[model samples]
Target: MTQVPTGETVTAAEFRLFKTRSFSRHFNRTLHISVYEIHRDHSNRQPELTLLDHESIQAGDEGWLVFDVTAASNHWLLNAKYNAGLRLYVENDEGQSIDPSLAGILGRRAPRSKQPFMVTFFQANRNQIRSTRAVKQLKKRQQKKHSDLPHPNKLPGVFDHVHVPDGRQVCKRHELYVSFRDLGWLDWVIAPQGYSAFYCEGECSFPLDSCMNATNHAILQSLVHLMKPESVPKACCAPTKLSATSVLYYDNNNNVILKKHRNMVVKSCGCH
Candidate 1:
């Protein structure tokens, strides 16, 4: 319920208990803990709260106990204020003990460094590529006229925006060496001064074949576009395969540490 990733569904939530905490000799060294969600009153009073999930867990050698509060965490991610409270309970056949810390999620004012935290995991993949078959087919009236000439302003970076030299008409992978020093990134990147991060180039013409790595959907889409050129865009030349690049970067905080940024290389090209 604390400082979790928003927008994305929380896949898992972990609540940890650190340092000296004991249930009693009744349950030996183990404790049965149930985590619950607290919902605020829509009328702005205390709306309500409900039980999400629970588990019985034992402490480790380090006296650490981690409980999965994912069910509650996901609900909060939807409408955070909807589930506005936290209740931890210890239940046994003898009786159930409830600890209401209406204090709630990360937004609540809790003691610094002492507040119970939720370590949430999210399926966070920010980079998204449009599939080859994802071209939009527009209506004739909605289409507008455009020139075949290229844009006057040009810049170089990666993937589709790369420049294709004259005579290279077929879509294919091209060698492109990225120089960290030229970009003033050599201070962090300590390994090779540069690497050949290939980029895709050229055109996706009619009858897009396997040579261009065009799927059947792309082939049909291209054929449809020829009859109505203003309604759809042609397929783009872009990377279909990508591989990570290992770089030595220093995180010097007194001691030096090396880290790898695995997102800057493309391994293959395709019309997509």
Candidate 2:
């Protein structure tokens, strides 16, 4: 039901389930989630199962059902012994005989696009980029030091700060044209090799204007921050609006598939 955070590095994990063509009750189904790990239970030799997050979703349309599993993924990264994957169970309402959600698209028979997948984001080390020509030009121009190395404070629902205090810079969107071919993804992606995804950047201060798309709660939070300072924080520049991107890539079966990846593109950004 919510979009995952895209941080400076791989600070988040998102589980995307392609829920377009599912054999189940479509209107409103309760999706229960859980993660599997290593367990030492004496009663049985089953893997350790830990519950994660759940939400109601409609499966009638061709879209992605995203889930935040950052903690689970981080745990796996920290210890390999506990990385057994996860499960999504759809509860049947009114005892309608919805059978075990063997409904999940699994095994080698499943289509690559329809099968569940995870999306991750990361960035280069600051020390690695300090010697680049771009860095030299930015240094020559004397751009703000913070812009080069930002330790963004994480915020809820796709919002993250640039670590620029007092919001001196204007909050605005930036152009980010992504080219699959340039990224050497031409082996898989077959059509519309690139797209302008754009992104939200810069800093925004209080008394946000019409362009900032400040919510009522954000306005109140700003006022509270001004009064108490430490109790609350200012809003961050983020994507207030987003759109899906249609990807034409090859599946595991070596078939060219065109699918719409939800929230794949950032359309318009605002201070939120």
lDDT of 2: 0.52
Candidate 1 CA-lDDT value:
0.51
lDDT of 1 by residue, 147-197 (tens): 242111110110122223233566888889999899998887677788888
Please write out the lDDT profile of model 2 over residues 14-55, one tens digit for every residue. Answer: 666555445564423543333333333336666556666665
Q: What would the C-alpha RMSD of candidate 1 be, to one decimal place?
A: 20.4
The per-model lDDT (C-alpha) reads 0.51, 0.52
Model 2: lDDT of residue 103: 34
* TM-score of model 1 (CA atoms): 0.37
RMSD per candidate (Å) reads: 20.4, 20.8
Where is model 1 more than 4 Å wrong at Cα? Answer: 1-168, 252-255
